[model samples]
Target chain A: MKTRIDQCLERLRKTRRKAFIAYITAGDPGMAETVDSVVQLAGAGADIVELGVPFSDPLADGRVNQDAATRALAAGATWGRLLKCIEQIRRKSPIPLILYSYLNPLISRGFEKTARQATAAGADGFLIVDLPAEEMEPYSRILGRVGLNNICLVTPTSPSARIRKIAGLASGFVYCVSREGVTGMQKQLASSALGLIRRTRRWTRLPIALGFGISTPEQARAAAREADVVVVGSAIVNRFAAAPKTAAGRKAAAQWTARLVRAVKEV
Target chain B: MPRKRIDTEPDAHGHFGPYGGMFVPETLMAPLQDLEREFRAARRDPSFRRDVEYYLREYVGRPTPLYFAERMTRELGGPRIYLKREDLCHTGAHKINNCIGQCLLARRMGKKRVIAETGAGQHGVATATCAALFGMQCVVYMGKVDMERQALNVFRMRSLGAEVVPVTAGQQTLKEAISEAMRDWVTNVRTTHYVLGTAYGAHPYPVMVRTFQSVIGREARRQILKQEGRLPSALVACVGGGSNAIGLFYPFLQDRGVEMIGVEAGGLGIRSGKHAARFADGRVGVLQGTRTWVLQDSEGQIRLTHSVSAGLDYAAVGPEHALLRDLKRADYSHVTDREAVDAFYTLARWEGILGALESVHAVAWLMKNARRWGKKDLILVNLSGRGDKDVQQVSAWSAKHGGPKA
Candidate 1:
């Protein structure tokens, strides 16, 4: 089966507009809301949905995303529960799902087991938040063997020479961190990401997705104009915090996710 | 597999057994690739070691003396105590021992700048010293809280032409400072070297740091043989990221007669969960780059750690210690906040040596356990840093506790 990363990119290029990639932390409040949010993202025009695996110390994340992860983890989010959410999301949503996590959880789960499980759970790829490209051999091999795309990250700080190296190794799409800090709602994407995206284009035909600090629809729309996929994460997770503690709260969160997807997909 | 070691290889993906591996985010891949290649080449070059060794001895004052703590040992009423006097080294700590070595490598690599994270501010002071010595631009990131507590050191860094950036995020502690430093390294890998404070982080770092710090053990081993004609019965030091302990323990690790013990800060109390006792609570995991004992939740999120000493307030131990623990090569324990405070006073009054709270934990351990060993039994503790900087904090804390009036 063609991985969701591949399909999403293919559809995105044909559409002329950008791929709407929405992000939500797993088990934010509870697992049901998380799963519902994923499906809602798909229904609301998100070409792909990134599911953040909560970790205690998200060194790469900004304040907003970090707080979201803490909230999710405190609510009893576990690897098993996250996997179950992915499985449930796959039952309804055909949009590609990427498991965004730090290297520690995968190490504990055993990379091979995580790869196989992620693939089986209908995860098209993994965006290892901490597994930089130089150390990609073991993870990429496992991901390739399991038919899962091992997504790589390229940052605005990445030099031209390194950009070529990252684009070559990247599967799915390259996650271009628009800023030096972790994922959060930024006032704007870094001006350097555009140059990075252009440099990355010289190396690979693969889609380049802009993330980290892309929160507002205008920012997403601006970022979308420059890249194949515009990725938003902390914004979706933040919405759940404001929702009520009930079934309607979860649906409301799902609706919020859908709205984000629609906003990003707007031409 | 019974897991023969405390650390594993493939770098969590599968590289060195415990002490070597890479654990960074995907965004850092390209830079790390460049670093790994350069490091592999640097390690193989004989001149690299020669230059590092020369600077370590001449610049940072290597072969730091191991002085027998005659007064404190007699008062403690048991084993003879010796101090690996890193406090007497340039800049007043063992931190410069590694900084000098790393700075030389950075120069050789043609790097133009140095960046470092400071907890107690010792390492930042050390890094700034080296950067100034090398004529390189230096930036030091320290938690805002630490900058306040260690204002003198902050001023010292600025005097050495280093920019001290105060990190205000999160708990405003060492962990956040490290996070900010790593981000800076990733962003400026082309021209900057991150002078990591401890023997932790990704592959090569744990190994490189230990290698640089090995002089502590080498000198102590030689001094003991020349002075007392035999090895000590016990070796002790505080464990923040376990570098100082590793530095002192490396040469003695294979010697069965020498007992190696690491003391972690049992801040206030272990049960309070506000201590930097990684061995007591941390499990084997990867953070930054290497597999080590880390105090993290089930989801592998790094937790906020606490300690009276900024240097000891780390959430992970060096990978070598993790391996040593698994192999049963060392005994790791903790001393309570009250006990450490008591030891601090004892050192000042009995020995006239003011000790860092991080180092006080080791003193506390020796004081608490001196009676258990025979009179002839010798114990050596790595006094990793001096306490001159902590005088104010200690005085204030003592006043609050109703001790000798501040």
Candidate 2:
């Protein structure tokens, strides 16, 4: 009787290893590379892949992620195209996919329709970077019915009571926003994420995935040692953003994703 | 319609919604947080409010008069028009209304410098006036194009002892000036207060600014009741960051019969795909601060907008205005660049007083809709600022009318 998200979490727990959460911006530079990167992450040992859907004003993001989103948006990334890329990746890969976005896109796309389309495209869950639990009922209702989990973000600043409330609504796993700023490749993970993990433990038994500043293999190793899942986004998106928009560029980016995924998955 | 308790994110500190939050590099976050904490305490102190109000009334010119435009009303042969005369304030516009309040807050927070972004240069002049009054270091970031268009105001700010930093990045316009001001704020968060010209941006700001500017609508409502015995049938104003429109609309928002109309600059035309009509063409998104409607592409890049008036050409509309539109409390519309220019000239000829090009968009709608209203019906427009700064553009407009053959 386990939900798809609960099953995903159980799978991660039984492995008892750090679940590699490979993060890449959806349609950075181009859609073709985005599809290739997702597949490569799955093939190379990423337990779960977080596909960042770019927004114009990512208030929560740091500078690096903001630049990546601006580049992707400038190159013609759209929701329809991003969904199409997810559909293409699902055709051949069974990687647990989570679409990460801000509130505006979901509201604009009509919450019910977007949830249905996301489920149809094989997306397992969603993490709306800005929509907190207090304002989540409208969106959570539609997502709940479609068997797609709504991932909640618990920041270092969130009170223990707020953490429990957020965890009560979350299904897949609780995404611990490891630090204050937006998602970016950082040299060091704040020790604060450990404290947040310990605090959230009081709220629910859901697995906690640490994100928002994890960059290198060493940082990933540290985060993995503490939490059930280690999320890496800006570093992978940087590779895709820097690569040229061509067949060769996508191949190179995929190779890059494979290398990062390998580091996080080591037993 | 259940009202959920509004919550604030810890990382946001003092920012409102998504629009008003701290986004400085790692080094400046602590100082920004300190400034915000101090501002919070100072804001609650009654003595601080009394001191600021004393200065606002005696110095910055609070409670500007409400004038009924009988001549224009008779000529239009329909609705009577009234103007909340914000242009008569000390700095010649509503811009100074918030500047005085921020200068006081900056002094209490112990900040010694003031920086601002200017498009029409009205805000720069207003900020410069406060800096001179407070003897603080004032640096105004103005786009090169605006600096050229409003050269006299540039000279005016310098005369007031403020340095004008001409910005030439991105589009060479107001949008670029804002980007540069943000960069400046990031570098100097400890000693600088970005006197945002409108009611937008992170959390406390939208609320703080609206509170400061609310005096306009407050005074207008009382004056209208005393002079005309009831509120007007419609309220009209031009919206850039929407401060003036908000100033005129806030007190009347609950009045079921009062209609609020915000006129956006439609550049050439909305259908021509070039205008500053965020509500007309933009999707709901977050920008600068607060969740609002913005002119952005699918990937969330803020797009460059065009308008004949420098002050009205912003890619994002204010967050409160977005909420009002969503609730159907106000009607948002557009006026073409050509129509605005014609209205600007007509107003000068019809009335002895000239108006800023930014406010002419609203005047254009008034001219178009005047015939539809009955003789006794009334409309109140926020006559935001004077047109003296627009001589160069207006001279060229006049030359085209009579001076030379093209």
Candidate 3:
């Protein structure tokens, strides 16, 4: 049986429409709000939902996502709680969910056990920000055994050889970083991103998802034109963090996500 | 039965047993691989070795005296104590040894810029000094709290033509500073070499730093043999990331007669949850690009660590130390903040040798265990740095907590 992520991307390819992946820190504001936001994001046309597991030292994240993680961690987010939130979301919706995390938490739990538990909890895959392609062999084996995807990342600095290696290991999609820095919303997409997408296409048949620094609808539209999917994180996370408690804030977040989804789908 | 030899370790993948692997982001993988290639090539080149040796001999002042602490030995009247005076190095600490070597590597690699992260500012100052000497651009990331506490060293770093960037994230400490440095390296990997300050981090780093710092052990070994006609009974050094301790311990690992002790910082006490004793309180986990013993909560979030000495205020130890502890080759212990302070005063008063607060942890351990050794036994300690930069902080701490009675 195909995984939910693979099926979602395959279906999107057939429709000639790009996938819109939305990222938010789990347990931000609170767990209940996290569940509500994921459902709202899916309702707003997010083909895949990326739930960030909050870590104290999020080196790859910019100020916006970092603050979101800090808030979630402060609100008592744990690995167990994140899984529970996933279970809650699974009950309500069949959205393809990816657990985005740093490597320590998974290493602490033992990779095989974490992968098994996450698979059982209905998570489709994982995106470990710090696990380099070179060190992903054991993790890939564990994830493969559990029939889950281990999403691999490609960067602007990634050489062609490295890109091919990562592409070979990637299961669901290749995350192409739009810029060289951490995750954040930028006013303009990086000029080098187009070249990266073109280079990555030569190596993998899997869908390419461009993320990092993609914020505006125009940027999302442009990214959708070049890649199979576009991931918008910091902008959506910034909305919920600005006013975590109020209904109006969540409505604004959902509205912005829908706008991004609409722009990507139009491409 | 003979003990196993400790020379052939870390293997090819940088694993000291189950610990130590390159646990960095994909962005850093290419750079780390490039660094490893350059480092391996440089190690085999005689010219590179010559350049490092020249800098060590002239610029950084190597072969620092290994002195017999006659007064302390007489006072203790149990074990004869000697001091390896890394405090006499040009930058006032042993951090210069690794910095000079890395700076030389950067120059040889044709990199124009070097970046580093520092905790107590010793590594920052050393990197800045080397950069000035080599005419390379240097940038240092330091925690805001550390910058305030080690303001003198901050000024020293800036005066040496280094840009000091204060990191204000996650309790504003060494771990945060390192994260910031890693970010900078990722963004500027094309023209920069990260001068990681300790014997930690990715594969080539721990090995490279240890190779550069093993000069301390080599010198101490020759000096002790020349003076006492034999190896010392014990070798001790404070283990903050384990560079100094590893430097002193690496050469003597094969000597079954020498007992190596690594002293970690016990802020309040181990049970108090306010300490940097990774082996005692930390579990095996990956952080800052290597799998080592790290202080973390149940959910695997890195914990905020505490130590009177900023240099030792880190959550993780070097991976080699973890392996050593697990193999039972070296014993690990910790001294409380109060005990370290008392040792600082004791060394200053009795021997007229002021040491960094980080190094005093080793001295504190010796003082506590003095009665266990015979009068004929000899102990060697790595006095890792001078206390000039610490006098202000130490005085303020003393005023608030009342001076140690010792």
lDDT of each: 0.81, 0.77, 0.91
lDDT of 3 by residue, A117-217 (tens): 99999999999998887678988888889988889999888899999999999899999988787888778999989999999999999999999988889
Give the number of the best model, judged by lDDT: 3
Candidates sorted by lDDT, best first? 3, 1, 2
Instruction: For residues B1-406, write the lDDT of model 3, one tens digit per residue.
Output: 8756775378776778888878887888877888888999999999999999998998888889999999999898888899999999998999999999999999988999999999999999999999999999999999999999999999999999999999988889899999999888888888999999999998889988998899999999999999999999999999999999999999988988899999999999998999999989989888988998999997789998999999999999999988888877799999999999999999999999889999999999999998889988989999999888888888888888897643
lDDT of 2 by residue, A199-234 (tens): 998898888888877777778777877788878887
Error of 2 at A165 (Å): 2.8
- Per-residue accuracy of model 2 over B242-338 as CA lDDT, tens digit each: 8888888887877868899999989878777788999889887656545677887654556778887888988888777776776677899999877
* Model 1 C-alpha lDDT per residue in residues B12-122, reported as the tens digit of each score: 232445444677765555555556567667778899878877887787777788888999888888989999898988999999988988888788889989999999999
TM-score of every model versus the real structure? 0.83, 0.78, 0.97
| Global local distance difference test of model 2 | 0.77
Better TM-score candidate (1, 2): 1
List candidate 1 stretches off by more than 4 Å.
A1-18, A26-40, A70-94, A106-124, A133-149, A154-228, A233-267, B1-16, B36-59, B401-406
- To one decimal place, how large is model 1's interface RMSD in Å? 3.3
Which 10-residue window of candidate 2 chain B scores lowest in summed lDDT? B20-29
Poorest 10 consecutive residues of model 1 chain B by lDDT? B5-14
